[model samples]
Target: MNKKRLSEVIPLWKADKRNYVKKSTFSTYVLLVENHLLPYFGENYDVQEMDVQNFVLEKLENGLSQKTVKDILIVLKMILKFGAKNKWITYESFDIQYPTSRKSHQIEVLSRTHQKKVMSYIQEHFTFRNLGVYICLCSGMRIGEICALTWEDIDTDNGIINIRKTIQRIYVIEDGERKTELLIDTPKTKNSIREIPMSRDLLRMLKPFKKIVNPAFYVLTNDSKPTEPRTYRSYYKNLMRFLEIPDIKFHGLRHSFATRCIESKCDYKTVSVLLGHSNISTTLNLYVHPNLEQKKKAIDQMFKALK
Candidate 1:
């Protein structure tokens, strides 16, 4: 087989890859490769399963989440597959195992009281920027999606928020120099391009703006220029601090919305669709947890049915 270092093959793979994926997705792949994979295995001419297993363990030790580690591995495999296709290296399949932890991972969400307090605060003192947060809480839209939204996408007459696009700043590496660019693209998956019915309050809040605001301008900025996720996240953090609410990551807003839906006994499939999840299982895994009371009630109902 032809022997070549992985570093040598990466450029060729990336050149071929750039044509096939979205710019933001390609940037993500490049970042994962540069930050995680290249440093570990760039100079090596061959990669073995054991090497990958060791790398996984090291990444885990470095506090990378299991999902992030797996994402890095996926990029690794793609580059290797491309190299193999070009006859530059022999690619072998890796079956890596992760250490199972006894600790249960809990999803972060704002408590119901805090959620209501934040929503109430936004409604009482409404700015266009703050309205974005209110929209996310009511419709379960992601930060990127909400940032990319425009007045045109909000149909107050129908009370529907069209979730068609997302915006983020992506890091791009070219000629060994790294730069970031704001990218506005369609949602990552087809499922994410959806329609969410607005709550009555959300519809009322947006109706006045819909008549006066520029249809092409971004919702958050109320201008032709869109605010990037990083900037919006910073604003969210400061807002939480000012309101004396315990800070959670920005994604906690979406989680909080989904958790509220589940708590309301909304159907799992409906919640999944509203959240734009690819499948219902993802929604269930993240939000469906039966408390002791619910478990006891379920058991009682089963015995009653038998009797």
Candidate 2:
């Protein structure tokens, strides 16, 4: 069977995305095609709306997670977009409504006390193995950004860590055990590349571990092999266990670092820069939301000021 022409054209489109889009984004596009798409679409030489709609409806009826369905839909739309570009499929706004209901889960940041406790636990139980976790807790570096850190990127003398590249998970593959490809690439956006001022505490903590020369490309690695995010996370879980703390996602550290900075009266812009946020507005919206806690504080502070 001569594979559909779209199969041939898809690679070209992905190559375009890689060159024009961020590495993380390109990785996402590629995964959608490889895992969810190619498996099903490989048989469909010519894609049709009725076929796509039936597939989507079936996925919904089968009770797929909203997130999974959303991902599938996104890839489908992108593929249709590719087809339209090549005149294989006529372009039009989607006709049928997509299954919608599940709102994105809210990320609850650590309260001041909880954040402090977590930090204190990390500090007290700190080991060389978890030095990277400790640094991220204090510095608000994203997991990808920190994992991409190179020995040359850290400047102890200047008390700074240069933010250049990030390590992002692109896809899960089967090579016996489920595996994910980690691509070390540039930050999410131009603003994601910024110099973050390192705290003296972190600088001093890292001083001993700092290698004078690292032949391996990455600063964070084991046995000269680049460490995968999953293994790095296993160590974090062990650290939390040792400290008798509740297990939280690695991203919570980002929230904790941001909250601590706010509590310490670090300017929002500085915190934003420290986090390497592409936009200050995004930092405020996500990390600096004016929730019930802040609302109460605002009213209380206003009354106090009047008094």
Name the best candidate (by TM-score).
1
- Please, what is the TM-score per model? 0.96, 0.74
TM-score of 1: 0.96
lDDT of each: 0.93, 0.72
RMSD to truth, every model: 1.3, 5.0
**Candidate maximizing lDDT:** 1
- The positional error of residue 265 in candidate 1, measured at the CA in angstroms, is 1.2
lDDT of 1 by residue, 127-225 (tens): 999999999999889989998998899998899999999998989898889998888899979999999999988888888889998899888989998
For candidate 2, write residues 1-307 as lDDT tens digits: 3234556656767656667776566666676677667767655557777767777777778877756767877767776687677666444555555766777556646566766676676577665456677778777888877777876788877888898878766664344254567677788878889887888787886666565556345666633556667777787778767766677888888888888888778899988888878779977877665769989999999999999
True-structure lDDT of candidate 2 = 0.72
Clash pairs of candidate 1? none
Model 2 ranges off by over 4 Å: 1-12, 15-24, 38-72, 95-104, 108-126, 168-182, 207-224, 293-307
